[model samples]
Target: MAQPRKMLLVDDNDESRYQLQTLLEFAGEKVVTRTCEKTITNIEDNLFALVINANSLGDYSLETITEKYPHTPIILVDSNKNHPLIQQQHDWRVIGSLALPLKYPDMMALIRKCESFKPEDLPSQTINSGNTEVLFKKLVGKTPEITKVRENILQLTDSDVNVLITGESGSGKEMVAKNIHYLSKRSNNKFVAVNCGAIPSELLESELFGHEKGAFTGAMTKRLGRFEVAQGGTLFLDEIGDMPLPMQVKLLRVLEDRTYERVGSNTPIKADVRVIAATHCNLRKAILEGRFREDLYYRLNVFPIEIPPLRARKEDIPLIVQNLLQTLEARHKKKIRLSSTALKALNDYDWPGNIRELSNLLERLTVEFSNQLIDAAEISQKLKQQGRITPSRIPEARLPEGDFDLKELLSNLEANYIKLALEESDGTVSRAAQRLGLGRTTLVEKMRKYQIDRDDISETDS
Candidate 1:
């Protein structure tokens, strides 16, 4: 017989608490539910695990709990992104935050993580993976679109080609870049990523190319640049379109000559780094407008991989939810599951912010309504209250008040989003398609399928 698992779930939502009980029971674990108003003094020592909803525990002091139960591992389920206590702390070894819309896999992962550690070693950084780490976990789904992207990644991984990944701001571009580098021969080497748009132009040169001794006024000592440090590895240039014209010229030289002169140094240093540049901007248009360089664009566009947006890959939502939930549960130390209605609401909505937005919503759900099975009503209510969740903005179908065909509405929404995005982008099919996370060619095909006009759109090769 298996030992019964004891769990303590603290949250205010009645629905979440009950649903969480059912899920944990089904998982063959005994669960003990409580409200944040109840003190930790009530909890027995050596319980299976303790999961706290950070939102409800706002009034309750954390320092008190840490002092009282220093032996027990505590996981914090956080719904809100800006938690006062969470932001104030620097290193919280015991406290891991999970954003909501509860997920079962995430819960199990968290439990497993807790079980792997001893109470005496409670506040430690290293998490023991054991056999769990080797478990073949799929990060996302295998939609036809995603399958093709995966195939392309596999093909690109073995080669040392400089790749250009173009997509919308939050369309999982970095994840794709990391996959490519990890799968490639340069997996052993460092994968250094630099956000070209975020850094000031004045500071970007030194960041990419090492600064020499007395390189500038504040040049205290010689420091190796990102490129030199990432030697025999991959360098990810995010938001490349924002690079200044002067920086673009230097970047172009680096790409072509594979050598760069450090600041305050005449001698050129060899940089054997594979470049993977990403941008949300239309580089070709930027080049035409003289905002970006044409030569640099071609140099980085050797192997272009464009990630589809959340709207285009609706099929992947379920898988993404699962993956994200598992990640959250492990971090938050709570077990939460989603209801059919909740899943439908997710499917119906056109996620403008993409995967990042979905993850945020889930995190919120886990903290605000943990310990319950979350349905559509709860999801809508919570999202509405937060101002982050909006009703499905798809234009094609008139969704009546009563029960409707979710799958049909979703398909219509996807097609309509693509068609409208294309139209709004001045028929610049690529931009419109990119807005929908579709390839230029895919957008043209989708336009034809939806009986929309493709003639007015401009398709400049990237």
Candidate 2:
């Protein structure tokens, strides 16, 4: 068996340190306890898996630990989840922060997560020659609409002008923002995203500009906002049309001055970040109705990118499906192929929900038809169940015109049925065999023949 990973627990409070150390030992982890007064020189950073820093040590700030062990991951522990120190510290080395007294399960889970961390998992600044092509492929189409989107992204790379992306909901506006960020010089820094529609108006200011301790009710600690966190990087404001008029005025000021103050503090901070805003709603209509500010709209519309709805580019369905299936296969470790007729059935439909809806449907199909060739009949049945397609709109599944291998077709049918049985039986081999009316050993042999293993069945359990 492998050795237990060593973790460093630093806290000045003896009682709290003892409790955590005991818990870690009980959970089969090697714990090294240290008081805040200890010298940094005494500790070997590379020997420990992670550092659990609880409470602020006088002159020994979290930044001190981070600078000393630049490569090590640190988990901050505080009495308040929204502690000022937590917000102030934005170093990438800090994986997360937790409130104390700690819960056993949350602590253990975080420890396990840290143990799995690899240095290479951090985002790299390196971009290969095919970086543009690879980023465009994420948009997943060669149609004129998508090609123009790619070209627009390419144009925006050389400049730091604000971007306004208008698209239908689920049409990949955020993906476009991310592509622009990754392609720009700001790729190495944080790419902070905020959904303006989701945050309430009362809290939106603090969410964007952060707030000082006791700025408002229940504001026990100072917190850093999206703008501060996204310094020297890109800030993506999604669903900008939904922003309240009052907040829009404040945002417009920040845009014009390129500076903003915290919710309570009068100190002005320079906003060196690039802004990218996206909205599905028609901002011009909103402006006319006086629901959205016309001035803010003009300020954000410096460079606009309008994404074509999925229905407008039905010809790209086949390529999108192939891409989605490849992703699903990588995640589930089971390949799923669609027949020509199935592709036609998808192409025929109007995707009101765009790529997001298509991705959901593909995931559902993967669960129902793992390691199987999906036909038009199955696609139509699923779509009908989803209330997306009417009976009249269902396409007919036609057989191949040329001669086919009957044996291979029969084998595929058998494997699909066996896999379905295993799924319905909750991945129990014995239960699956009984459902298929076969001996357990015979069913196992067929699973081997079809290359279906315990790994595939276990994925279904998840």
Q: Give the TM-score of candidate 1.
A: 0.56
lDDT of 2 by residue, 1-462 (tens): 865557777877788888878877898888788876563666654434544554647677665665666556677788876666665433445556677777887777667667765442332122223422223435767689887887888788778999999987668888889878866777646789987855657889999999999999999999999999999999999878778789999999999999999999999999999999998878999888998999888899999999999999888888778777776775676778899999988999887668876776788899889989999999888876654332466479567789999899889879977876664443556556766899777988999999986446422100
| Best candidate according to lDDT | 2
Q: CA lDDT of each candidate?
A: 0.70, 0.76
Model 1, 1-462: lDDT tens digits are 865667777776777678767876787777788876664657554465667667776667766665555555666676675886444322122434555666777777767766765532222211113321111113366677666666667677459988999887567777777767766667646789887754657888999998988889999999999999999999999878878799999999999899998888989889899899998788889988999988888889999888788899998898888777766676677657898888999998887667766776888788776777999998787656433212463246565899989888877867767655653343445456556777666766777777777454331111
TM-score of each: 0.56, 0.58
Worst lDDT 10-window in candidate 2: 120-129
Error of 1 at 289 (Å): 1.5
> What's the residue-level lDDT of 155 in candidate 1?
77
